[model samples]
Target: MFFTEMWERFSFYGLRPLLTLFMVAAVTQGGWGWDRSEVGAIVGIYASCVYLASLPGGWIADKLLGLRRAVLYGGALISLGHLTIGISGLVEHKLPFFLGLIFIVLGTGLLKPNISAMVGDLYPEGGARQDAGFSIFYMGINIGALIGQFITGFLGEKIGWHWGFSAAGIAMFLGLIQFWLMSPKTLANIGSEPSRHPDPAIQAKQQAQVKLFTGIGLALLALVVILVATGVLTINAPIVGTYLAYALIAIAFAYFAYLFIFGGLSTDEKKRVVVIAVLFIFAAIFWSAFEQTPTALNLFAYDFTDRMVGGFEIPATWFQIINSAFIILLAPVIAGFWTFLGRRNVNLSSPVKFAIGLGFAALSFLIMIFAANVVIGGGGIRVSPMWLITFYFFITLGELFISPVGLSSMTTLSPKRFVGQIMGIWFIASALGNLIGGLVAGNVDPEKLELMPKLFTTTTLFLGGAAVLLVILAVPIARMMKERKGADQPIDPTQEVPDLPKE
Candidate 1:
């Protein structure tokens, strides 16, 4: 599962560093020659779609294909999407490019959520070891990301854009093959079948619902096609981005409302739900800042930062390696620090950790303040690469503080019946952030380089203000999160946890 995800991320991240740059590249340079705003809109829409797809992806896995088959299908779709994009480079029309993105979006929606769910399934008896396992899995994700950027970034920039995109396709194909060969024996019993009600009547009802949904989905697809073909519908970057943003927020709010009004949750569960809602907002804010690395920050590396080191010009994409490297180096250290604190009975609640994470996030932009000042003071002279490196380091620190903790809290705080839904909500926050972050990055025009300082300053202030707000509310939120006596904890020393789902 870890390797599968690593390669998947490799392909995903590999494409990201190239997307905006390729969109805005001149015709002679094999790009669409779109403006920065357009590039931002495209990238933002693409990213947001990827995360948002997880909602239906999870639903499909649970109700239809089961995890194993869903993963295989998803991988195939992703590979095909990459190939389609590769083919688009040779064709005069832009249809293949957009079609390719559509396939990738659908495929990722199917794969991403299911794969992580399988990871949790690997350890039915969840314990400290489960947390350790996920850390290892996260490391795999970073490994793929680092290597993917190095390889694809080089190929895309130094050779041809199509070649870089093709590389991702090839990598994903290899991952699919690897998973197919090894998973049969290794995960024979895990996620092999759909989970369903044992009762015949209930099962029949579910089957009916699934069929109804399938018919509705197909009809909607056809409707969209007719609309597009007849000129009744038009699609562009901003329009798409705006709609996706609105839709995601609406879905999140509707889901929360349903859970509160109809979920039959206890008062304690309701309180925790409130915490989750607050955390969701915080998650969105953090990701909006963190996700800029692949868009706005990528542009920074290309246009504003000095890429020359000892007279040897480095690839702009190489700057991406810094964040991944920092994660690999710092993750274990941070994990160990948490463990050390845990052993001493010092519990840093999720809200507190998140607040600190926001601070670190702001600190990354704070470092950039100096870098931006240098460029402004020098009248457009590029700053040293070290400044970007420092910024990545601080942001990576913030990620370490927030991301893992956020995942842990999701599982711990959620009601068992809605655990999957809560996790989906978490991803939605990421989706929303990606969309907004892309817009933020799109505004970064290299020609108007003077705006860079203001951009960095704005990010710093936004992050800092969020951090301050979290700090002010952390105590109350943490209090809400505190486990009430005899609420969720095991009462007897030898009895198994009540909510542990049977295999």
Candidate 2:
């Protein structure tokens, strides 16, 4: 599972640094030379969709495909997606490139949440051990990312963009092959089947509903695609992205409402769900800032940062590896810190950790504010690479606080039956963040260098305020998260309703 995730991330991060760069590059340089705003909007939408798909992907795992099968199918699609992108470079067509992104989004949706759920399944008695395990798993993710960004970034910049994309595809294929060979032996019964009702008649009805909705959804998607392909539909990507930000908020609210009003969850479960919802908002804020590394910051490296090392110019894409490198180095220390605290019964609650994460993310942008001012003061002269390195280091620290810890909390807190879906919900926070980050990246115009400091300042203030707010709320939120004596026991459907404490 670790290797699979590692390779998957390799494919993702490898291509990520290239997306905006390729679109904004000149035709002579094997790029389309699209406007920055258009590229940012498109990339933002694409990145968000990659995570947004997780909701349905998790549902499919819980209902139709089972986690293992979903992962298998997803890996295949991802490999194909990368290959399609590679082919696009050779053919020099827009259609294949767009199609490739769609394929990857779909594949990631299916694989991301389900795979994480399976990891949770590995340690049913979830606790500090699970947190440590996830940290180790996270190391796999960064290792792949670090190597992928180094190699793919070099290939894309020095060779051809498509070649880097092709390398990513090949890596995913290798991961898929190894997973196919080893999963049966190593995983055994884990994620082997879908969770289904025991009543055959009800199960059949549920299956039929799944098929019906799936067919309708696919047909609608095909219609939209066909219309767009034929030029019957015109898209203002930035405008659409602005609307999507609102839509994401609405969707999250509706989903949580449905869970509270209709889902058969106990009072304790409801409280944890509320806590998740609070964390969800804060997590979205954190991601919106952090995800800019591939867009706003990537552009910064290309345009404003000095990359000359001993007179050999570094690839701008190489800077993408800094975060992953930090993660690989620091994950063990953070994991051990959590375990040490856990052993002493002094570990920080998830909410408190979230606050700290937000604080560090704010600090990262604070550094960026200074860097942007340097550019303004230097009359657009390139600044040292230390600016970005310092920013990534702080943000990586923030990520360690939120990401693995949050994953552990989701698995441990959710009702057993909804683990996969809850995991999907967690990724939704990322989806929201990516969407906003992309939009923010759109405002980064090299022609208007003065806007850079303003942009960084706005981000810093927003993040700092959120951090303070979360800090203020952390104690009450942690109290809400405290489990009752029998909270870990299997919930019995036949049990009577019990009056619970108010929120």
Candidate 3:
């Protein structure tokens, strides 16, 4: 599972740095030559959809395919997606490129949440041990990311964009092979069957509902694709993105309302859900700022930062490795720190940790504000690479505070049957963040260099303010979490499944 996730992330992060750069590069340089805004809209939409797909992906795992099968199928699709993208480099048409991205989004949706759920399943006695396990899992993610960025950045920038993309596909293929060989032995019975009600009648009804909804959703999606393909339904990418963001927010709210009003949950379970909801907002905010790395910040590195050292120009994409590199170095230390605190019963609540994470994220942008000002004053002079290196460092610190910890918390707090869905919701927060970040990146026009500082300042203020708000509410939220019934009891794997409430 660790290697599977590593290879998957390698494919993802490897492709990420190349996306905007490939679009914006000159046609002669083997790129699409699109404007920053168009690229931003496309990238943002693609990135957000990658995470957004997790919702349905989680549903499929819960109701249809088990977690294990989902990961297998998702990996295959991702590999195919990358292959299609690589082929696009040889062809002149855009169809293959777009199709490839869609495949990847769907694949990630299935693999991401379910795999994390499986990791949680490994340690049913959830506590500091689970947190440490997630932290270790996170290291696999960054290790892949660090190596992927380096290899793909070099291949894309120094060789060809398609070559970099193809490399990602190959990595995923390798991981899939490893998983196919080892999973049955390592996983045994874990995640082997779909989650279902104990009553056969209820299970059958649930399956029927899933099939009906799935068919409807697919039909609608197909219709949109056909219309777009025929050019009969021309769409503005940015406008569509804006509406999608609004729709996502509405969907999240509706889902939570259902959970609170209709779902069969205990009072303590509801409290935990409420905490998740509150943290969701702040998590989205943090991601919006943090996710800028592939868009706004990537462009900044290419256009304004000094990449020259000893007559060698560093690839702009190479800068992305900094975050993953830091994660590899610091993850163990942080994981141990959390364990140490747990031993002493000096644990900081998830909300408090989220606040601290937001603060670091704010500080990261604060540094960028200074760097942007340098560009404004230098009048075409590129700033030092140290600016970006430092920015990534602080943001990485913030990520450690939120990401792995949040993953552990989700698995711990969720009702057993809803684990996959809750994990999906966690990624949904990331989806929202990526959407906003992409839109924000659209405003990062090099043509209007003066706006850079303003953009950074706005981001800084938003993060800082969110941090303050979370800090103020942290204590009450912590208290709510403590109210969980039998909070310290180990969850029984054989507990009777509750029937899902009818809509």
Which candidate wins on lDDT?
3
lDDT of each: 0.79, 0.83, 0.84
TM-score of each: 0.92, 0.95, 0.95
Scored by lDDT, model 1 comes in at 0.79
- Lowest lDDT sum, 10 consecutive residues, model 1, at 494-503
In the predicted model 2, the residue pairs found to clash are none
Candidate 1 displacement at residue 428 in angstroms:
0.9
Can you give the lDDT of residue 65 in candidate 2? 86
Q: Write the per-residue lDDT of candidate 3 for residues 357-403, one digit (tens) a residue.
A: 89999999999999988888887578899999999989988988877
TM-score of 1: 0.92
Off by over 4 Å in 3: 339-344, 485-503
lDDT by residue (tens digit), candidate 1, 296-366: 88888888888876877777887988888888888767867776786787767666777888899999998
